[model samples]
Target chain A: MPASASSIPDTVLVSADALHALAVRVLLRLGLSQAHAEAMARTIVAGQRDDCQSHGVYRLLTCAQTVRSGKVELQAEPVVAPTRGAVVRVDARRGFSPLAFERGLPALVEAARTQGLAALAIHQCFHFSALWPEIEALTAHGLAALALTPSHAWVAPAGGHRPVFGTNPIAFGWPRPGPYPFVFDFATSAIARGDLELHRRAGTPLPAGCGVDAQGRPSTDPLAVAQGAMLAFGGHKGSALAAMVELMAGALIGDWTSQESLEFDAGAQAAPCHGELVLAFDPARLAGGDPAAGQQSAERLFQAITDQGARLPSQRRYAARERSLQRGIAVPRALYEEIEALGG
Target chain B: MPASASSIPDTVLVSADALHALAVRVLLRLGLSQAHAEAMARTIVAGQRDDCQSHGVYRLLTCAQTVRSGKVELQAEPVVAPTRGAVVRVDARRGFSPLAFERGLPALVEAARTQGLAALAIHQCFHFSALWPEIEALTAHGLAALALTPSHAWVAPAGGHRPVFGTNPIAFGWPRPGPYPFVFDFATSAIARGDLELHRRAGTPLPAGCGVDAQGRPSTDPLAVAQGAMLAFGGHKGSALAAMVELMAGALIGDWTSQESLEFDAGAQAAPCHGELVLAFDPARLAGGDPAAGQQSAERLFQAITDQGARLPSQRRYAARERSLQRGIAVPRALYEEIEALGG
Candidate 1:
């Protein structure tokens, strides 16, 4: 057993390294190939490092159960192929979305070189966990990227009793002259089910209008929200956006929308394959051959905001990240114990 | 006077062709060259046909006034150039956004052929009018597109007393397998000024939570909404989206941002040029020669809606367009008289 596994539950000092390694081991035990296991582990671990516990290792146990139940494929490679221009299509073959993204990003990034802006849409893939990282990767390459995804389960259409829509998220990032990209990633829903779960666990009331009860009336109890449908952020507009994502990803990419009754055959456990679309543009394409000039232009704008005494969008999140990094990743004591007991 | 213009009293029953021609005549009368006048006319006509009355011929008077003041260069040509890949930049030179787009579209279309997607950002340009027409035009060529423009004069930042943001609008369209593309265009504001004006004219009550009074308290009076700052759609989220558009169009394009003083130059009714960003993509590339198939799959999922049997987002809009076309465009009596006055 790893030495760190012995020290798991007693203190609040879980090293990021230990978490990553453990996650990787768990993935391997769940039958992922070595490379894929490592990739999935890193993505989820990074999510936790960024304080996205809902998308992080906390979901790994569910993922494992899903895998054992034959829902998610642990060792499937994406079918990546080029079509026209800088566009590429990937059929995930019931594989993990992170794996699909890992395979597709290189091609999409390289395509941006010749196309100025490139796009990729993946169908038949499971959750990629977090959108920010995918967009952040493009930003690292000095590209402004936007990504959208549709879900296979867990949400309903607005004004409808049946679950027919996914939370459907949108992620966008613009490369800045600063150390980090200006990134915005959010679901069209008022709040994520994960957050509801967290509040339910903590016995906290949800913010008003976040969700509805099973009967579709406004409810503040997190547990009811978890069991019932989540409302779109605003009324019609938010629903329109979520519906747009459904059309863009599920419809445009040729995936099963959540509205279709779950097929319980060979493909039933074949990872509730969702749909994803990514668009990345190179800013240099418009900066008159002087990449530095575009950077300066963006910098000046940022300076204007700072000088005018306005805060950047992710400033608070960045601060939280810094604090967590300085200390260590936080985890519940019960969770750490459970992870230790599940060690293969 | 055109003979057909006489039959409609509190209205103008002009053909699309007739309207375009008259718009060109008006622009030329305001000192624009024949070609620039035609380009601007076509754009405005397109907006009218698309039902974007607010940005259509409704603004002709203001545009004429601006042109007379030499705030808008009547015959100025946009400086069109390429960026890295399929990116084009147009220095509008205080020209109309439509003219900027007209000069920029050919290159962008060409870029889309080889780049999968083309992105164009116009700096120092006047209002582009309704975004739907631009999107509609692109969709005519079987492309998916999105356009964003930051209006700097009419919206308030979240939790702020003064209007520091524009009703900054975001427009996105996708070519479905059906007759018309799915287009969604709306301002980040709770309600557009035109909608409020309509409410005021009809003596209708404004929707709650849509606007604030002079003292910054929420108000349901359309008049108050017009006089005071409009609320954002979904509180913090909508505010964030508006801020994003400002950053993308104004800051990224080196135009302007809300963080700067809203008052540009008094007596300068000529507002500083706004920034416009347009993105065009070919879904066929990402769909791998199967856009129709993908769209079909999406339709199945979307149509499974248990609410009203799965309706498309633009279904109502399309039906409205069809009805309008069949019954002739419905114009308010006051607006009809207003345009008739323009002719005189």
Candidate 2:
């Protein structure tokens, strides 16, 4: 493989399949089981294909370090409890979450189909992947889905100085008639931890209100925020949402809170071990009128969004996906070389 | 009831029972049926008792006008479809939503108890009350609840200049071992439409980003924003949430979108008649571990929030409630006179 210097500079153009194969080999070499490797690879590839670089191959570095830190059970088998009474439980046994989600998704889809709504709870997993993938999974089954999960405690409550809450992302997906679903995944925090880390690595100043220093004064220094705390987006409202995620995905699910997850990390900065809550709704079953009418109604909302030049939540991602499929993804050549070397 | 002049000035001290009686009488005088009057009265009194002024007796003025406009079914009875497969459906018959919700709460509670999680879809109602009462209803049952509803299209989507979404509110309540359930109900818009109207009436300027002018330029003029569009909180994330509410509470329930609701009003500006979605989760049924452990976990999160000097959402409201219970609510003398005149 060679860098595509013909058009783009310092970028390697690689097919999705080739990237998946490389990711799988890398995961396998790093000690993941076959199922785990494939699930993880698929998620990473999807991130790349969708141009969500934060969740793409950049994640491999942290994952590899996490495995080396003796924190993750790379080959652990996930156990799924049979779906009943609108709840689907999957015990990830302290392993990576992707494999557990894959095992539990079918039962979730079936339950939602039968009951009009269903919940999927995955326990004790390294929940490092973006929630959009999980949400998109349900959307693909023609279901509306909501996904929530806690992360390490690096964000402060709206009016507080200390970090007690996680980035705590909430994701939602609505099924539509076309290839793309109306999708959005956003952190309750002012900014995602990954983006903060990116700024830290590049020695860049954060946007105002992104974080506070150790003394609780607002600061743009990513390093200071890394040492102190990130602020919740939209102030108090976003903070309330973060608390909701913590309570629903953490306490309600009988799992660790962000504070607990951080303590478990012991300063390793590894993937946060926690649980996830995914709720799916079958529109055809849930809607009282004709399902087609509901779908048409959804289409009108989307069209209205575009008509006003307001982009849908995942519009850019879908556009990037199309471009990637046609012209292959553009990965920084240096990063590509580094990822390739990780397989050895 | 005579005005209590011992401590507070320019106020009339009225007991909850007395206030309820007055509100009920006023609602009935406005042509509401007994059941509708009682339900609306209870909600209005609850707001006053909680010190939530926006939802208190101030709402009676609007309720009276709406009834006069023939927009509400003063004597209509809500129909409840029995719980089936985690779904509890209610038809509000174009009446007030409070009564419909009251009718469906029991079925939703039963369904959640049986299925671990359940959804209540209330269709075609004049949803003029605050959502906190509906949320508290579920939390009182030891269930975690999430409620969403769309109002008139007075807000713009993020990045767009046109009004297309509503001041859609998302309310959540989590049960705890305390006097108050952890509760938060906030509009997806930068500020509630009621607050904007208040600012306009008071000749006060709005905070930056609260809304835009008729030309879509950022403006602090509440009247201009009223003529144009209100902005969503936290920018795009809040906008995305507002869209979700429109789809779920509107399209998914086969009811009316904010745009549709606005069009239906035909510039009447009456209460936006639409649907609502309330999802409940029975903690014991949903938890993978001992139910007590889950409860304790929730308690810990609450404690942590307070320990960090951060006040939980609705803390002030709860405190106000305790004060109101001990020493009757203090109503402004002029408003008390106004309400009494309306009842006559």
Candidate 3:
């Protein structure tokens, strides 16, 4: 099939289907179970759907290579069980995150229904792109949710020279009365480490303080940022947030901090250790039988704001989702060519 | 007793007692209940001990004024109950946060034990000082936790002005192998609004792109940052995260967005519509009688990093905590004089 160029200038967009097919093939070729491959592929495709191409098909090659090298186990199955006080812990057994989360969330949901809320700590898992989709699953069931994942590399501690933490993204999803629910997700780093790769490929300059040079001083060179380390967002505050996620996701799950787990040299590999922390709450617990009424109040408040010309959170994304669905999800020729090459 | 004229240097150490006494007096004079005054005072002072001065007694004057204007119902009692799910909600009755949280957390604790994890959402609450302490309370029971709060003002949506959000902050804590567990809390703004206030008072300059003028142009002038609006920490991503908090903390709780909640003038009293989200999980649920073993693994992992001369999250605050406990908490002379002027 002929490839189409991405409409987003400077960005190469690939069709979700093409990306998913390539990702699944790569994962399977790397020895992942068919189910795991499909799940991982879907996750990667979701990232692209949400304009997170850096985490989408772009990551497939690296993920496949990592798995093939045994840096991320492909055959592992998560072992999930109930913990004290409504907590559920999943020993991901060093598998992909979707498998762990899929196994863990049911337990959390069951517990939350009985206990009013629940938490799941999935330890020793591989990456899951775009947390919003993960948390959105819970929000769909009337549960408000938050998720945190600690990465294996690319952040520095405050005032420190060396990279010692992950970008450490936190994501939250809440059901609202709007046409679409509001969701927010972000990394603690000033810029996602994935951007470093894009910058490297495109020969673009990075924003200052996004990362450090070889000497550990701040730099705007993508190569240095990738090789040295990414800086935390908001200086001390961002560092603190990153550090917090390390404790919550890494420490709680008995995984090494991203800094310690990093294998910077291309030939080096990270240990099979990563974790995610998920918390779920049913807002019905707060609104009683009057959720509709409470939502009405919220709608009224936001309507007042809209009356003043303010847009609601996720409004743009909601619009984009509709447009994308209507337009059959556009794919750029450049990204499609890359995917074709990888698949071949 | 005559006030001591001694200076605490870069560290303005004050005894916990003196700080609490002064804080209580100020709140009481501003019309808070004795119990509310005490809780608020302790929570605020606790942040000072943790070196979270921005969220500590530093905001006392604002709270006092907030209470004075009847925006905050000083004696309001929270309404707590379980909803359809095991979830618990606390209506702050438009009161101060410490009191509201003190009322809400117990419900969350009870709910978490049965649910394995539970979330407490407190709505219409005034400012809560330093989210770490609230998470600390959960950790005391050996529970890992996450907490988030929305500030009342001084942040803008990405590429837009008009102070549409606050320096929303998030905190996460985990229990570990020592007397001090890991705790991290920080704002999502490039700089805290309080820092801008400090700059305004001290005649200092802000780092570039910290905020923008009223016309939505970037500025390094602290005064403008205050009167105009601060930018989200990492541009688009940070803005998205803050928007998520708005839904979780504001819309979910039936409050308006920060922009909508603002009263006419920027500095004048705005409607106190802040909300908090808390999640707690017990590690034992997943440990299966091997809590210590899991903790040991986590401890070893953290120790390995520290052995390499890497600092753990909150290490500096823990050090400050010890120093304060041993040397007595310090109070700035100016603050001391200000407290004395309150005739405590």
Candidate 3: tens digits of C-alpha lDDT, residues A128-176 = 5668778877877777787888776667666665667788888877766
Give the winner by DockQ: 2
Best-first order by lDDT: 2, 1, 3
TM-score of each: 0.86, 0.99, 0.83
True contacts kept of each: 0.41, 0.70, 0.34
Task: Pick the TM-score winner.
Answer: 2
Clashing pairs in 2: none
TM-score of chain A of each: 0.86, 0.98, 0.85
Ranking by TM-score: 2, 1, 3
Better of 1 and 3 by DockQ: 1
Q: What is the C-alpha local distance difference test score of each model?
A: 0.70, 0.90, 0.70
Q: Report the alpha-carbon TM-score of model 1 versus the true structure.
A: 0.86
Q: After superposition, how far is residue B200 of candidate 2 from its true place, in Å?
A: 1.2
Give candidate 2 regions above 4 Å deviation: A2-5
Worst 10 residues of 3 chain A by lDDT: A263-272
Query: What lDDT is reached at residue B234 by model 3?
Result: 67
lDDT for B86 in candidate 2 is: 92
Question: DockQ for each of the predicted structures, in order?
Answer: 0.41, 0.79, 0.34
